[model samples]
Target: MSKALQEDSKARVKVLGSLLHTADISNPMKPWDICAYLADRCLEEFFAQGDQEKELGIPVQMLNDREKVNRCTSQVGFIEFVITPLAEQMVIIFPTLSFLTRNLSLNVELWAELWKNSFDPPTEDYEKLMARVNKVVSRCRAAGPWEEEAPMRQSSAQSLLSGSESVVTEH
Candidate 1:
């Protein structure tokens, strides 16, 4: 059973990585749009891989563009239906998701502080970097279940300087 669960998790991670990479290449700076697209793809794959009527608890046919558009527009509705549930699942299957969120949140806050001191007329490179940062921050913030959890404590000052340090310490 544990092996099967591991295999299922591996499959989901592969699918998620594929979806994220596809969205990154195709939609570049639009995080929300990319997330919406991936969510749709996830729903499709989830249904295709399982007994939709029994396993999903929701009708696969109803997961159409119209419904997606409606849900995406309503932040409360989107969180309730998509982000909340996915975050819960991530805690079980992808502990890294929680770690990623914590790191990204810290990065976003750090970047915002840096920007305050470094504020100037935005260069093209700066704008692009900011866009990428924002995308990561938004995704992290939207990773629902981990949002309310206590922020992970940092043990070393070096961890504050390099985000990669946290990943190393975690292992």
Candidate 2:
């Protein structure tokens, strides 16, 4: 009788697995709009976790806590400590994958810029400024109804920086 094959445990297999895992978590390495979309999804998940933890009377984790978590700060921490380090090491391991680190670096700069200009409140009284920035970002990211059926196109970070939404036409 034939038996099922076991999973590969070779060194190369392990390295490839690690690279694949990094790629899965490398949304920040994508263009700015895609990163924003992914960040929105991540926040939704974190909020859900926080809600469940609160309902269960368990202590909420910082990232999962909607009230305590500042998205910009948390994202900076995540990219700097988590994504950048991993991508840098991955590039060393696989030189052809250096683009991963490059994109991560660019994204770090973008996030830092956004945080400094918009998300970072100057003082306790600056909450309104942050809210306004968030509203503008939300509006820019809003998708039209046809977006669901259309092939997604990646938008450059420059477009986001410029705060211009390009008109789309149905072909």
Candidate 3:
């Protein structure tokens, strides 16, 4: 229902809309524990919707059906197909946004690892999964937006103080 979703929007407007949409779906780029918590909450909402659909005698959507859906598989598919592709395209528009791609790749790698071991239990113990997740979270935290602040912000500040117009781009 957003104007950005309209097919006839101007190029700049469409790009901005797409950027906003990408950010909305970029929750997986957050710290692992927080990302996992958000994902769990989303699934809970889907399950509730499924329950309502059932009560209304309507068929449940594949993702919303708690009984039939495989959480690990679904999450892996979402990250691989949805988040990764979006982040890749977004980086083209805002080159400094590669951090989004990096964080998303980390999340996808972690999710893919979990998905691969979903059936091969004993090897995928809680400790091992948590260790991998924690590592990714730490790496993501270190590579977050704050990491780029110093050079870019400092350059902009210096340029402003010198009354010079300069643009700083993260390579």
Candidate 4:
């Protein structure tokens, strides 16, 4: 058990415990592919719940509504808004657990890329989507604290843009 998880604060015990138990550090060795699979399964459960809710004449949870949900973007929001912040705060309390935040950060980046690609796709292609996912998965670095941290790459609009792509658009 992580030292952070073991210590429970009275004022924030409920939330703190929830975040600690669900954070990446709780299952550090979990494979990325398995994580994606589990997320898909969880979404199915949510969709089922929404269906049941509709049958019962109740309002469905916003994201749980199968018709409106975008798997990639919803996941990105959850990880970015909830999980990453929790993991990052935990890292501050336990510097040794910094790797947890690094893993989470990369996960958010992956989801963002997926969202950017499929945000408004008029047509879906399973083979192409899987190829993109696999390519992104291939480039993911393992969350190993022992590995040397790579230097951050610097980029600006001038360096990144060459074609008709504009960083900002006029309304």
TM-score of 3: 0.61
Clashes of 2: 0
TM-score of 2: 0.65
Candidate 4 global Cα RMSD: 11.8
Q: Is candidate 2 or candidate 4 better by lDDT?
A: 2
State the local distance difference test value for candidate 3. Answer: 0.58
Better of 1 and 3 by TM-score: 3
**What TM-scores do the predictions have?**
0.29, 0.65, 0.61, 0.56
Taking all chains together, the TM-score of candidate 4 against the true structure is: 0.56
Model 4, global lDDT: 0.51
By lDDT, the candidates rank as 3, 2, 4, 1
lDDT of 3 by residue, 58-139 (tens): 9899888887765655665676557665666666656677677565645545454444444444555645655645544444
Could you give candidate 1's per-residue lDDT for residues 85-150 as a string of tens digits?
444344345554565445434434343333323333347645665565565556666654354533
Which scores greater on TM-score, model 2 or model 4?
2
Model 2 stretches astray by more than 4 angstroms: 1-9, 120-157, 163-171
Which stretches of candidate 1 lie above 4 Å from their native place? 1-3, 7-92, 95-97, 122-132, 149-171
Taken over the whole model, the C-alpha lDDT of each candidate is 0.42, 0.58, 0.58, 0.51
Which candidate leads in TM-score? 2
